[model samples]
Target chain A: MTERTMTKADLVTSILLIVFSAAVFLISASMPTMAEQNRNPLAAPGIVPGFIGVVLFLLGLAMLIRSVRRGAPAFFAQDRGKPSEVDRSSWGRIALTVGLCLLYALLLGRVWFPLLTFLFVFVFVTAFEYDRKAPAAGQWKVPLFAAILAACTAASVYLVFQYLFLVNLP
Target chain B: MFEGLQLFGQAIVSTFTLRALFDALWSTQLGIIIGMLPGLTATMGVALLTTLTFHMAPNNAILILICMYIGAIYGGSRSAILLNIPGTPANAATTVDGYPLALQGKAGKAIGIATTGSFLGSIIGMLAMVVFTPLIGSVALSFQSFEFVWFSIFGIIICGNLTAPKDPLKGWIAGFLGLFVAMIGMEGIHAYVRFSFGSTNLSGGISLIPAMVGAFGFAEIISVMRVERYEVVKTKIDRVFPKLSEVFRYWKTIIRSGIIGTFIGAIPGVGEDIAAWVSYDVAKRGAKPEEREKFGKGSIEGLLASETGNNACVPGAIIPVLTLAIPGSAPAAVLLGAMLIHGVRPGPLIMIEFPTFIYEVVAMVLLATFMMFILGLSMVRPLVKVLQVPRQKLMPVIFILCVVGSFALQARLFDVGVMMVFGILGYTLREMDYPMAPLVLGIILGDILDKNLRRALILSDGNLAPFFTRPICLALFLLTMFIVLSRAKWFRALLAKIFRKNATA
Candidate 1:
C-alpha cells in the first residue's frame, strides 16, 4: 500500500481495535470470580483475557497516536478517482470467487459430497477461464477441460477422504 | 550418549523398511510439488497433510509430515532459480543469486548447488536437533508456571518484533488478537468458557487445523487469484550436478550459514525466511572482496548459503516444538498440533516419556533429507512441469482441499465456517502489513500463557514477587521488556547517543 492508504487504514484499524479492546475489558470485568465455589480469584477465567485486553488497548492507542501524527486525517480529504478497468476486473473476480466459495460452503453438507465438489470446481474454473473477449465458439474447450479436472478432483477427493483415510464425508 | 546413539540407530533401522521408504518418497515428492507451486507454503502443506495422516500410526504419520517439511523447504528454490519467484517465503533470499544464474543459462547448475546445500544444511540441523532437544528438554523440566508465563510473552514479543520489523505494533496486535481467539474455548483449569457468546461450537473453541487451513490455504488461494500470472524462464540443462570441489570450495560459508540458520530457527516464531536472509547477509560480509562483489549477481556462495540456511532451519525450527511445546516456526506449529492430535505430547517430559521419539524424529529428518536430495536431483524436468500448472485451474482444487481438510478433522460444518472467517481475517491482516507468524504463535501459546499465568498467580497468592525473582522468569521478563523497549524510537536514539559518547571517550 501507498503511504496515504496505509495511514488511513491504520487510523481505521486502531479505532476498531480500541473499541474491541474496551468491549473485551468490560465483559471480562463482569465475569464471575467463582469465589463462592472456593476458586482462587487470581485463577478466574477472565484474568488473562482482561490483561490481554488492557495490553491490546495500549497498543491500539499507540497505533492511533502514530497514525494521527502521520496526518491520517488529512489523507481522507483527498478525492480518489474511479478504479481502472483492470482493478475493476480484479475486484469482480475476487467477488465471484468469494461468492462461489460461500455457496459451496453453505451447500456442503446438504448436497452430495462428490457432486457438490465437482460442481464447485467446474464453475470456478469455467468462470475464471471464460474469456468474454474471445469468440463464443472457442469457449467450449475451457469448459470441457474444467469438467474433466473437476470430475477427477471430485472422485479422488471423495475416495481418498472416505475410503483411504476413513473419514466419513458429510 | 551411547544409549541415544543406539536408539538413533534403531530408529534409522526401523524407518528403513519398504513401506516407510515409500511413504518418505511420495510424501517428499508431494512436498516438493507443493513447495514449487507459488502461493503454496510449507506451513499450508503440513497443515493440510496433518488431516490426511490422521489414521496412520503416530510414527508413520509424523515421519510423513517431516518429509513434507524438509522437501517443501528445499523445493522452493526451484521456482526461485527457474522463475525468479520464491515459491515459499522462505526461499525469497534464494531468488537474489538464483534467478541471476538462471538468466545466465545456468539454471540447472543453480538447482544442483541448491539441492546439495539443502542436504548439507539438513544434516547440520539434524545434528543440532539431536544435541539440543534433550538439553533444552532437560532444562525446561525445571521451569515453573512463573517462568512459562514470561516465556510465552517473550515468544510473542520477539516473534512480533522480528516478523514485523517495519511496524511491530501491528504484529503485537495480531498476536494478542490470536490469544483472544484462543480464549473463546473453555478455560483449561476450570472449564469456564469466555467469549463464546453462548454458542456450543464457540465453546469448543476454534480448532487449530481449520483456522490454519483458512489462514494459510484459503487466504493464499484468494491472494494468488488477485495477482497476475508469471512466465517460466526456460533454460537448457547441460549439467544437474555440481562438482564436489566446487561445493567444497565454499565449505566455510556452508558451515557458517548452517550454524546461523539453525540458531535463528531455534528462536520461537522465527522461521526459514529470516534464517535464509540472515545467512545470506552474513555470508556476504564474510566473503572475500571479489566473491562479495558477486553476492547478488549469481554468486554460488550466496545461493548455497541461502539454500542451506533455509533447509537447516526446517530442522532447527522443530527443536523448540520437541522441547517446549513451542513452535520455532509456523510450519513447526502445525507439526506440534499434529503431534498433539496423534497423542504424542511433546514438551519438557518428552525425554522421559518418549526418550526414543527424539531419535525417531532425527531419523525421520535424515530419511527426508536423503529423499529430498535424491528427488531434487533426479526429477528436475518433471518438477518444473508442476510450476506450469495454471493457477486458475489449480486454485479451485486447492480450495476444495481446504474445505475438506478443515471439515475432515471433526466432520463439523462449523469448522468450515471458522476456516472462512479466519481466511478473510488472515487476508485482511496480510494486506495491512501485519505479520501472521506472531498471530499463529499467539494461538498456539494462548493456553500455555493463560493456564500458567493463573497458576503462577494462585501459587503466589496474588503476589507478583516470584515472577520477578525467579531466575528463568526474571530472565524471560527482562528479555521481553528489552525487546519491547528496543523497538521504541526514543530508546534507539538514546542508545545511539550513548554509543557516540562512549566512542569519543
Candidate 2:
C-alpha cells in the first residue's frame, strides 16, 4: 500500500535551494556594484537577478512546506512494486555503460574511436542480457545484438566519414 | 504558376541524376536503420553522416544529409510501435499509443497507420516549406541583432515548455541555466571574460560537440548502466501495415496532426517529439467519449496522430533552416552543417543564391519518405531477429565505434576528455530526475541565446524595450506565461473548470 511521489525529495531540496537562491541574489546584487566600479554592465542587473532569486526562493519555500505537511510515501523508502512496471533504469546497467564510455574516452587518442566504441557497445549490451533466464537461444541475444549494432555503426562511420567525407576516424 | 512549375522542374533536374538518386537512397536507408535502433538517434545519424559527406560534391552531399534527415525521423516510429520505446526523441509521443496497441496484438495495424501518417505529414510539411519559405524569408530579411535575441529566447522557451512533463517551468529554468552556461568564457559582445576563471580553454567557452555529447549521449548511457537491464514486455508483431479502412477512419486526426506538426516544426528549435505529443493530446481531447477511452491503449487514431505529427515536423523544421540558416532541431543543425560544408549556404536569399535548391530539397524529402516506408515495413521482423547475434564479441565492436565517433570530431585528445567528462556528467544526471533533452537544447541554443541577447542590447545601446514590445516578442511572452501557469495544479483545475462551464452553457 505504499505510494511514491517527488514531494519529500522536493522538501529537502527546496530548503537548501532557498538558502542558495538568497546567496546568489545577494552576490548578484553586489556584483553590479562591483561591475560599476570596474566599468562593466555585464556584471549584474538589478531586475534580472532580483527577479530570478525571489522567484526561486518563493517556489522552494512553497515546495518545502508542501513536503513537510505531507509525509513521503512509504514507497520512497523501498523499490515498492515490481519496478518493471516503472520507467526507472537500473544502476548496474548505468555503471557498466559509464565505465565503457569512460574507457573509450581514456583510450581515444591511443586507439581509434571505432575500435573502442565497438568493444564498449558489445560488452555492455552483452552484460545487460547475461543473467536472463532465457529460452536457451535467447540467453546470448543481448551480446549478439550489441555486437551487430557496434559493427554496423562502425562500418557506417568508416564508409561515410572516412571514405566519403575524408574525415579521419580516431 | 509558371514560376512554380519552373521551380519544380529545376528541382527534378537537379535531383534526378543517377548519382544523386543513389546517394539519397543509400543515406535514407541508412538513416532508417539508425533511427530504428533504440539507442541511436536521428540527430546522431545526421551528425555522423554529415561527417562522411564533407568531402563529396556539395550537391550530392546535401542530398545525402537531407535524405538521412527525412529518413531518420520517419524511422523512429518503428521502434516506438514494436518495442514500446522511442528510437528517437521525436518518437516519444508514438510510444504512448503505439506500445499499447502492440500489447493488444495490433502491431501491424498500428505500424501501417503510423507509416501512412508519416508519409502524408512529410508531404504537408514539404508543401508548406515550398509555399511559405519565401514569405517567412522576407520577414527574416528584416531581422537584425535586435530581433535575433527575441527569436532565440522564443525558440528555447517553446522547446522547453513543449518537451518537459508537468514542468515547463523547470524546463525553462534549466534552459536559462544553459543560457547562463553559454555566457561563460569570453563575452560574445566584447570578449570581456566573465566566468572563464582564467582558464585559456575556458576563454572560448566550451566546444559545442563536447557539451552536447556530455549532456545527451554520455548521460543517457550512464543511466542505462546504473539501472540493471530492464524487462520490457514486448509481444510478437505480424505484418506491420494498415488497411485502407483503418487509415481512412483516422483521417481527421491525420489532417489536424499534419497542420499542427507543420506549424510547430516551422518554429526554430522545436521538433517532432513536441509535435507528436501536442497532436496526441489534440486527438485525445477531440475524440468522443468512447474513442477517448482508447487513446492511450493503442487507438489507431492516437498512433496516426502522433506519427503523422512528428514525421510532418521534419519538413516543417527544415523550412526555417533552409530559409533562415537557423536550425529548427538538433538534426537540422547538423543538416545545416552539411549544407555549409556542401557550399549550399542557406539563408534569406538562398533562393536567389541557388534558384532551385529549395525544390531539390523538397524532392529529396519526398524520396526519403518513400525509402522509409519501404524499409520500415520490410525490416521489423529482421530487426528483431538481429538480437540473435553474443555479448563478448559485440561489446568489443561497439566499444570501438564509441572511440571513433569521439575522436573524429576534432582529432584532439582534449575533445575526447571533454566527451568523457560530459558522458560521466550525463550518466550522473540521468540517475537524477533531470531530463537530458533540455540540456542538449541548452548546449545547442546556449550560444545563440547569449550572443543574440547581448547583440540586441548593444544594438539598442543597452535597452531591453524591444524584447517586450515587438509583436512576435509579445506573443512569445504571453505563451511563456501561459506555459508556466498551466503547469501549476491550480491553473490546470481552473482551466478544466472553465472548459466544463463553457461546454455546459
Candidate 3:
C-alpha cells in the first residue's frame, strides 16, 4: 500500500503486537521472579530471555505509540508496487509448499529422497510460473531439465554421503 | 614486506597443486552458476557443498567454501542484469542501473561492463586480503574476548546503521531482534534456554542456513509471485563487453569502487551487499551532474560501480575471516563454520599453528576471482537474452531451482518448511517497508554477539567500563549511537537549523 493507501491497519497491528508481547513477557517474567523468590535464581527458567522480553515489549510499545501518532503513511512510504509484492491470496499455496517440504523431511528415511525432492522442486517452480503466452517448449524445458538435474544430483549426493561417506542424512 | 612476499610465493606454490587450487577454481565457477540462477543463492550453495567437503582436507574444504563465496557474490549480477531480479541480496544494488541498461537495448554492453567491474573489484578485494590480513592480525592479536564482544556489537550496529539509514531505529530494532532470535533455543554460554517457548525445534534455536535461505530466497520468491507481473524488462539480444576506452574513462570509478569494496569487506560482520549499495550510491554521488543523470536509468558508470564494488567486497570480507576468525559477510560466516568443521581455527594463532594458511587463503581467493571473472563475463550476453523469455515461462524454471536450492540445503523437507516460513515473513516485512538486510545481519551475526558479549563480560569481571573506554570500542559505540540518533526528526531539524544559522552568520 502506498502512503495514500495506508489506513489505520498498521496502527492496529502495532498495538496488538505490543499488547501480546507484554503479556508474554509478564508470563515469562514470573518464571524468573518465582525462581528468585525460591532463592534459586540460577535455576530460573528464562531469566535472560525474560530480561530481553521486557526490552522487546518496551520497543514494541514504542513502535505502537510512534505508529499511532505519526500515522504510518507519513512515517513510512506506501508500498511501492514492485513485482515482488506478496499478498494474502498466495498464503495457501505457500502453506502447501511448506507442508510438502515437511512431509519430505519426515519421510526422508522411508522414502526415496531424490524422487520426493524432484517433485518438490518441479511442483513449486511450475506452480509459480507466470508466463501465459503461447506454449513455449523451452520454457517448460527448464523445469524438466531442473527436475532431471535435481534427481540426479540428489542421487549422487545420497550415494556419496550415505554409502561412501557413511553419514546419516534425513 | 619481504617476508610477506616469501609467504605469498610459498602460498602460490602450495595453492596451485592440482587437487588444491584447480578444484577451488572449478568449484568457484559452479558457485557462479548457482548464484546466477535466480532461485539459488551463495549461502545455500556453500551449505550444501560443505556436506560434500566433510571428508576433504580442511584446507581444501575452506578453499572450496571461499570459492563458492566468491562465485556466488559475482554470480548474482547475472540475474540482476538480465532479468531485473537480483539473484542474490548482494546483487540488489546491481539491479538499480543494470536492468535499465538492458531495457535500453544495451544489455550486452551493460553485462560486459558489470563483468569487468566484478573482475577488477574481486582482484582489488583479493589484493586487500593479501596485503592487509597480516597487518590486521598483528593488531587484532592485542584484542581479548572483551574486545571481541564490543567488536561484535559494533559490527551489528554499523551494519544496521549503514544498511537501514532511512530508519536507524528500525535497523537497531531488527538487529536486536535477530540477536534475540539467536538467543532462542539454547544460550551459547550457559545450559539455559532463552526463548524456545516449549517447542523441540525451538530448543535448537534457529538454523542459520535455513533462516538465510528463507529470508533471502523464499521471501524474495513469494514477494515476486504475489506481484501481478514478473516481466519487468523486455530487451533484444545484443553483444556484451565494455569497450577499452570506456574502461580507461572510468578508471577512477573502478579504482574507487574497488577500494570501497575492499575496505568494507575487511570490516567484521558487514558483507558485500551493503558494500555494493554504499559504493553504488557513492559513485553516483561522486559523478558529475551530467553523468549522475544516467544513474538509475542504467549508465555503465553505475553498473560498473556496483559490480566492481560488490565483487571487490568479496576479498575485503575474506580479510577479517582469515586473519581474525570474523566473517565480513554471511557466506564468510558459513565458510567459518566449514573451517571449524575442517579443524582450522582462524585467529591469531593461525600463523603459528598453521603456517601459510593465510597464504593459501589469499591464493585461493585470487584464483577464484579469476575464474569468477572469466565465467561471469561469458554468461552475460546469454543471460541477457533470457530476459525476453516471458514471465509465465521464466517463473516455472525459477520455481524448479527454488525447490532444488531448498532441498539441497539438507535433503530434508523440513528445510523447505523453514524456507516457506521465512519466505512469507520476508515478503510480509518487505511489503510493510521493513528492510530485510538488518534481519540478515542479525541472524548471521547473532551468535557472534551472544558469544562474545558474555565472554567480554566474563573477562572484564562483569565490568562494563571497557565497552566505553577501549579506543576501537568507543569509536564504534559513538558511531552506532550517532547513526541511530541521526534518523530522528529532531536531529534532522536541528542539523538543518544549525546549518541555516551558520550560513546567515
Candidate 4:
C-alpha cells in the first residue's frame, strides 16, 4: 500500500480498530460475574478488559478524526513517491517460501526431522535462487551452497536441540 | 554489608569453575552470532537458549542465559556499524554514528570503541545490580497489591511514551490491545473464562513465547522480504583496540551513558533502545559545538554513549527481575520465565529463599562481559562477513528457526499457529507505525495488573480509596498521570515556555 498521509489503509485500519474495540467491550460486558464464588463484585472478570476496550475505542475514534482532518482526497490520491505497484515475481517468491514453510511444519511430526528439514531448506533455497536471474555460474554455485547449508543446518539442529538440549523437535 | 561481601566472595568462587567459564564463553559467542544476524534479537536469543539449558543446574543455566542476554545486546552493534541495519532494536541508535564510521573506513575502530563501551557499561550495570537488587527487593516488601497495580500501569504508560515519542496514541492502543489479548484467558480470582469465544485454546490464554516469536521473528521476516536490499559498505580494518588516551577522552561520555542506561533499565518494561536514545541525546547535548556537529557523522563519543547505554541496560534490566519478579525488558521477561521454569522464584522473597542468587547473577554478568569483550575483538572479521550473506537465504533459515523456537517452548503446534497470527498482526501494526515494545510489556504485565487490582479491591472490601490513598500507590498513580499529561500539547507548550524563560535569564 502507498504511504500517503491519511491514506485508505489508515482509514480502514482505524475503522477496523473501532469495530474490534466495540466487540471487545460487548463481549466483556457479557462475561459472567462471579457472585456465587464469594468474590468481590468490583473484581469482576471483565473490569480490566472493559476499561481497555473503552480506551481502544476512544483512541481509534481519535485516529479516525485525525485521518478525516487530513484532506479526504489524500485517501484516494496515490502519490508516485510511494507506489503501490504489484511486483509479481517478489509476491510469487514470498508465496512459495510461505508454502514450503507450511508443508515443512505439516510433515514435521510424520517425517524424520533431519531429513525433512534438509529437504525443505534445499527446496526453498533452490526455488528462490532460480526465481532470480543471476550470472551463469550462479546456477551450480547456488545449488552447491544450498545443499551444504541444508545438511549443516539439519545436522546442527538435530545435534543441538534434540540430542544435547533434549528439545523434542518434530 | 558483611553478609553481602561474603555472598559475593562465595559466588565468585562458585561461578569461576571450568564449566561456568565454558558456558559463559560459548554462550556469549552464540549470543554474539545471533545478535549479529539481522532479524534476530536479544529476547529471541535468550528464549531460544532457555530451552537448551533446561537440564543444567540452576546457577549454570541462569548463567548461560545471562551471558546470552548480555552478548546479544552487545552483538547488535556489529551489524549496525558494518551494514547500517541494526541486528536488534536496541542497536538502532548505534547505526547513526556506527555506520558513518564505516563510511569513513573506520569500522574496526568503531567496533573496538563499541566493544569497550559495552564492557564498561556491563561492569557498571553489574555493580549497580549488586547494589540495587537488594535495596529494591527490600523496598518492594512494602509494595502491596495497590502499589503493584499502579506500578504495572506506570510501566505500560512510560514504556509506550518512550517507545513512540512521535505518536504515543498508537503505542497506547497497542498496549491496551495487548491487555485485552491477555484478558482472553481464565480470570485469576474466579476461574471464569472471559472471552474465549468457546475455544479451549483461547481459554488458556495466548502463550507468551509463540506470540513473541511471531511478533519479532516471523514479522521481521515478512518485513525484511518486502524491502529491497541495500549495498553494504566495504571498509578496511586498521585497529581493533582503542588507545588508552582515546578511552580517557570519552570516559565522561561512557560513564554518563552507563549510569543513564542502568537507571532506565531498572524501570519496569523500559529497555535498551530507549536507554540508548536517551544517552545519545544527552551526549550530543553535552558535546562542544564542533563535536556536536559530528554527532551523527561518526563521533566516537556518540558511538560510545549509544553502545554503553544499551549494554548497561542488560544488567540494569535484570535487577528488577531478581528483586521484584518484574522484568525490565523483553529479554528479561523471557529470562524471568526461564527462572520460573528452573524453580528459581525471584521476588521480594528471593533474598530469604536464595540469598546467594543475586551475587551469582552479578558474577555471571561480569563473566559474560569479559567473554563478550574477548570474542568481540577476536571475531570482528568473521562476524562482519555475516553482512555479506544474502537476506533471501538467511531470512528463510531464520524463519525455520523461529518455527522451532516457538514450538520448542511448549511442544505445541497451536503455539506455532499463534506465532503465525501474531507475525501477520505485528507486521500490519508495524506498517501503521505503532510501537511494539509497549504491547509486549502489556502482555507481560497484564496478569500482574489484573490480579493486583482485584486483590487490592478484595482487601479493601470493594472500596477504592486505598488504591488512591496508599503512599506508594499514590506516588505511582501521580507519576503515571504526569507522564500522560506531559505529552499534552498545552503541557508541552508550557514546558517549552519555561525553558525559553530559563535560557533568556
Measured against the true chain A, the candidates' chain A TM-scores are 0.93, 0.62, 0.60, 0.80
Q: Top TM-score: which candidate number?
A: 1
Ranking by DockQ: 1, 4, 2, 3
Per-residue accuracy of model 2 over B159-256 as CA lDDT, tens digit each: 76766665554456455545545555665444455455677766666655555544555554444344333234456777677678878887788889
| lDDT of candidate 3 over B329-357, digit per residue (tens) | 76776677678767888877777787688
- Model 3: how far is B155 from its true place, Å? 2.5
List the DockQ of the predictions in order: 0.81, 0.27, 0.23, 0.51
Superposition-based RMSD of candidate 2 using all C-alpha atoms, in angstroms: 5.6
Candidates sorted on lDDT, descending: 1, 4, 3, 2
Instruction: Using TM-score, rank the candidates from best to worst.
Output: 1, 4, 3, 2
Where does candidate 1 stray beyond 4 Å? A80-86
What TM-score does the A-chain of candidate 4 achieve?
A: 0.80
CAPRI tier of model 2: acceptable
Interface RMSD of 3: 5.3
On the 0 to 100 scale, the lDDT of residue A26 in model 4 is 91
Give each model's whole-structure lDDT. 0.92, 0.67, 0.70, 0.84
Query: What docking grade does candidate 4 earn?
Result: medium
True C-alpha contacts between chains kept, each model in order: 0.75, 0.36, 0.16, 0.48
Tens-place lDDT per residue, model 4, B377-396, is: 89688777767788777876
Residue B77 shift from truth in candidate 2, angstroms: 2.6
Kindly list the per-residue Cα lDDT of model 2 for residues A68-161, writing each as its tens digit.
6676544355545545433434444545566665665666557665676566566665666666665667566566677787777666766766
- Model 1 chain B is weakest, by summed lDDT over 10 consecutive residues, at B379-388
Model 4 chain B is weakest, by summed lDDT over 10 consecutive residues, at: B223-232
